[model samples]
Target: MKSYHLIKKKKNYNHKFLNTTFCDKDKIRQAFPFTALIGQTNMKLALILNVIDPRIGGVMSMGDRGTGKSTVVRSLVDLLPEIQVVNEDPFNSHPNNFDLMSQNVKELKKKGDKIYTNFIKTPMVDLPLGATEDRVCGTIDIEKALLDGTKAFEPGLLAKANRGILYVDEVNLLDDHLVDILLDSAAGGWNTVEREGVSIVHPARFILIGSGNPEEGELRPQLLDRFGMHVRIKTIKDPISRVKIVERRSQFDRFASNFLIEYQYLQDFLKNRIINARGSLKEIKIDYQYKVNIAELCSNLNIDGLRGDIVTNRAVKAFVALNSRKSVIDKDIFTVISLSLIHRLKKNPLESIDSNQNIIKTFKSIFGYS
Candidate 1:
């Protein structure tokens, strides 16, 4: 018989290896997988849709402490796909979205050869409550300006979070100045600076994510309206499910190394699903009636301004996207309204007498959902 090594057919060597650097290893290490999180279904759903379509502003989770509010927010990292960005760009600018590039950078791009793209893991920059205004909005390098007669705009958290997620823990406690800066940047999707005689503006578009306990303090109305979606998370009361959570956590901790190895495939599988959902969002359609219903609900609820309508529409679109649907439907609109509008209601002292019942009654009458 011929030798096996010589007789075996040779495999083709032309296939290219996929650049896996987009896979955010650091994010994964920092956050637990969404699938691994137990309970908080509504919170998880809102977050899922937001990640699938960042235009839904971003999700705000408010609830009791240790109720997995923060846990769910952090877990989002594992569900996102990697992104392509310009090499050496501090803002993580997409090589294709040149419209958002700065004037100087745009000119540079015209003169330079074709801009090269590099794969980077999607980012989720956390904005701590204690951060200062200067740190958040960025400061100029005075020394460099004086010595070299050149102005260098140091990027802030918003710049770093471009085309990615900006998570704020205990957002209600953030300083007023910082809140104003965040709100301004979030509203226009760009940050304009006119300080130290150095004028600069750059794209600061990012998904604004926040989680906090209501007991600490209430978020400002102006800032609250900026969020696209709001979710309330409560402690799991079921004995069995609670037990399972403990057991699962214990099992993972006991076999940390082996557990991660075994679950890597599962994590990647979820990431792929999210990527597919994002692609599906663009193809999904919405009917005029759905828009009318959204408007009616907001109007009846006495929601201020047109932001609620916009957020409601975006939330429904995101929900449909997550379902991989071709068009928006009544059910999608209703579900989104419940999650996005409940926390946003202007509290009435009279309504507070039986808030839950009154809210449910109104919802049933309007949307006819049980």
Candidate 2:
């Protein structure tokens, strides 16, 4: 079934992005299949897990340049299931996500005329480095105020990205204050704008995705902990994998249309699988033993709070669903431990050990060598 909802607006909707002035039309409209990406096993896994369960929290992918970090992030757009939205809603607010609806939409509904609706690609709005505060959080509609003396709100990037991905490339360079606003919205699932005597609130729930070079700078610890999973990518060293990546890009450049046609089936298959997985997610089983295992693993790591434990459990479920499995097992926990707890681990610069290795050691100690 489609999730549908109502929205109130002054202007008749135009689906062409009123924002996203920075996006390339071709890049935003079409992308290489997620299945086609080469290497970066952990990075791919981290991305897919977030898609499966946004409640797992958002993903942070940090690495050196030329590791396909941005490519991997953009290609995810191709595989997302279509979302039902009120016709022309700048926010892409869901038809049934009434909690996020405007007060006007609520009042208009009392008349009992069914609100019109349509399905569209779930957006992935890029938070450009130079975007002004008004562009990010919206501002009072100056035209409305001047022409008609009407106080109205103009939806901005946060509104447009509702129920979608807010991707920040080179996120390390983003202003700390802007990052703080995103952190608040990602945590609480709403954005409230109070400016020019205009107060408008809308749901800002989205899967936050950020990629940056670690050498440039690290995210402040307060912000880093907000991300549920952190993944690092390395340049592909295997000659065969490198060759495959180059060949794929060459083929794409040489015959863009043909390349897309060749992968269309694979893309559709993945899309349908995700749709089905989402439908059946609540039915997918997680064992009581698995719950205990997640808790014990986090405990052994001395990770603060239950976010680590909760995110791990959600990631394991997503992994099972993505693999078409109905239930989770011990091996699932082992696969997710590093992704869940790597960033949460306290760094001991003097200890001279990899946090990832420590994650594995903990897994082995808890579950025994297999």
Candidate 3:
């Protein structure tokens, strides 16, 4: 059987990978299957939860290099369903969206020529270390203004990345000013650009994914709290697991097609689960006792604000949805509470204990081991 991870089947094509790229790109970039990664279970779970529900806030992964952090984030691009966008529109605007789409798009639709659409692969763009404000927020088209005597807006990374993932590597090292912009857009789901007294606003709702080594630098508390969940990664400690990791990478390097074929079934299973979970999220049950349990845990941990309780609710629900279940249970909350609340807890100056350990202790105190 053909590997679904490698190329787009005829059934799923829309002929607009980048909307204006030379041709399809699914064949060019070969991402490792999400189901095939070794270890780092918590980190992988955090990524999957965010994919299932972006409102849980995007996840942050901080750990050592060569732990498959970037690989995991990029692999997620493969598992997402294609998004609909107005054809020939650079911003990838949703249909019938005049307020956020370009004026050209609005005019084209007004002419009633049966506006076409393309179901393109969702984007997963990188936020480079040296990206400028205009580069991230877009800028005014100076040459168009000077020559055509008309104003044009140049879409940037954020524009290309609407309804997609904005991954920032070494996130702790990103400039603080840019961090502020990320926080604002992440919270508001809109990116407004003002330059030369001209302003532009468009949909910028994307999951903010960042991976870095904390030893390089510390993430600001303000920004840290903004992440829906955070997890630490480490190299495999078991000798067999390490050897298997090497074997898998070697197989992928030497025979990518075969490697993908080996895991295509597993990948398809995960992809379907995510798709179904999204459709059923509204109907998934949320018990009040579960809410009290999450609130109690966050409160006892001294995690400030209601963000913890809020994120925990979303995460737990997604967790249940991921398991193909329709309701929340005490054990379901246990599975996600640490990931949701650990990053939100206030840190003590002299405490070396990790937040997950503290969360486990609290879990035992409240619900006892499960």
Candidate 4:
């Protein structure tokens, strides 16, 4: 088993894979397996759906720390199949996916050469809290210009994360300015750079996954709204369940070298399910009743905007697709509504609130959830 650590320098760092082959075997073993994690079904489901449908904005995991928040994210890479990426493309955009690599194509055409295509696996890049604007957004290559008198644009994390996951651990602690950058890029699915006499734009679309302890600080409402799904995870309280979690984790760490091989089938199963679900998602139909129910729920809960309704609808559709269901049902709607709406419902400090339970009960009564 090997230990994996992200080594960062001024504007560059070693690119290492947690589960991939590296000289240090112990680092890879240090990563907890996603399959061994217990409970937190909502968190797991949110992550799974986001992988299947990156269109669902991204997932936010808010809870106390040391509850395996980061572990679940790292382990997800093991579950996802490697994605094809363009070789030598700074942004790592898949050459085959022209829609996502349009900007790259334009740049290549300007250079008077036909762009060739190559494939690479999807990567999960972490955005550390202390990262600077230059590091995150890329900066001019002064040395390259000094040596060749030609401007060179260095790609940033956003570029590297293209067509992959951009994970921000303890995201609430990140600077507001950085958050704004992320929000703008994520909203548009592209990052445009026009500073330092360099104008460059490339595909920056990615699945934004964030985790933090809400007790430390509440995420800004504006940023909070950006997340398509919010899941609250807490340490399992049942002694038996807790013990089982510890045992499984211990066994995985003890046999880190063989852990992935043993669970390779299970990982492939989950990956295939996600891939198939994405295709099937387009076929799931939402009835007028479901729409009305969603709208009514939002209105009843006094949710701020139409985004909630949209996310709730998409989540229900994805949930049904995951289960291979052809149509959205009352139960599916109820479950999504609960998962998507509960975290957003505002609480009144003056009044004692049990809104979560109340909403669930009301939804059950309205939708006849058994």
- The prediction achieving the highest TM-score against the true structure is 2
Query: Please, what are the lDDT tens digits per residue for candidate 3 over residues 1-370?
Result: 4777446664245455355343323433588888989888998899888888888889889998888899889888778988888887777777776645655677677887678888998778899999999899999887777789777888888888887889999999999999889878877888888766667777787899998998899898878999999988887789999999899988887777778888899988888989898887877879887777778888889888999989999998888888889978778888888888877888898888877888998987877564
Q: Write one digit per residue (lDDT tens) for candidate 2, span 185-275.
A: 8878889987566567888888999999999999998788889999988777889988999999888777666787788898889888787
Winner by lDDT between candidate 4 and candidate 3:
3
The local lDDT score (0 to 100) that residue 164 gets in candidate 3 is 81
How many residue pairs clash in each candidate at the backbone level? 0, 3, 0, 15
lDDT of each: 0.76, 0.82, 0.83, 0.79
Best by lDDT: 3
Q: Estimate each model's TM-score.
A: 0.87, 0.88, 0.87, 0.86
Runs in model 1 lying further than 4 Å from the true structure: 1-30, 352-360, 368-370
Question: What is the C-alpha local distance difference test score of candidate 1?
Answer: 0.76
Q: Candidate 4 lDDT, tens digit per residue, 157-188?
A: 99888888999999999998898888778778
Query: Candidate 3: where are CA atoms >4 Å away?
Result: 1-29, 96-113, 142-149, 368-370
Per-model C-alpha RMSD: 7.8, 9.3, 7.6, 7.3
> Better model by TM-score, 1 or 2?
2
Off by over 4 Å in 2: 1-29, 141-150
Q: Can you tell me which runs of candidate 4 are displaced by over 4 Å? A: 1-30, 107-115, 141-151, 368-370
Q: State in Å the error of residue 72, model 3.
A: 1.1
Checking candidate 2 for backbone clashes, the offending pairs are: 4-95, 4-96, 5-95
Question: What's the lDDT for residue 52 in model 3?
Answer: 85
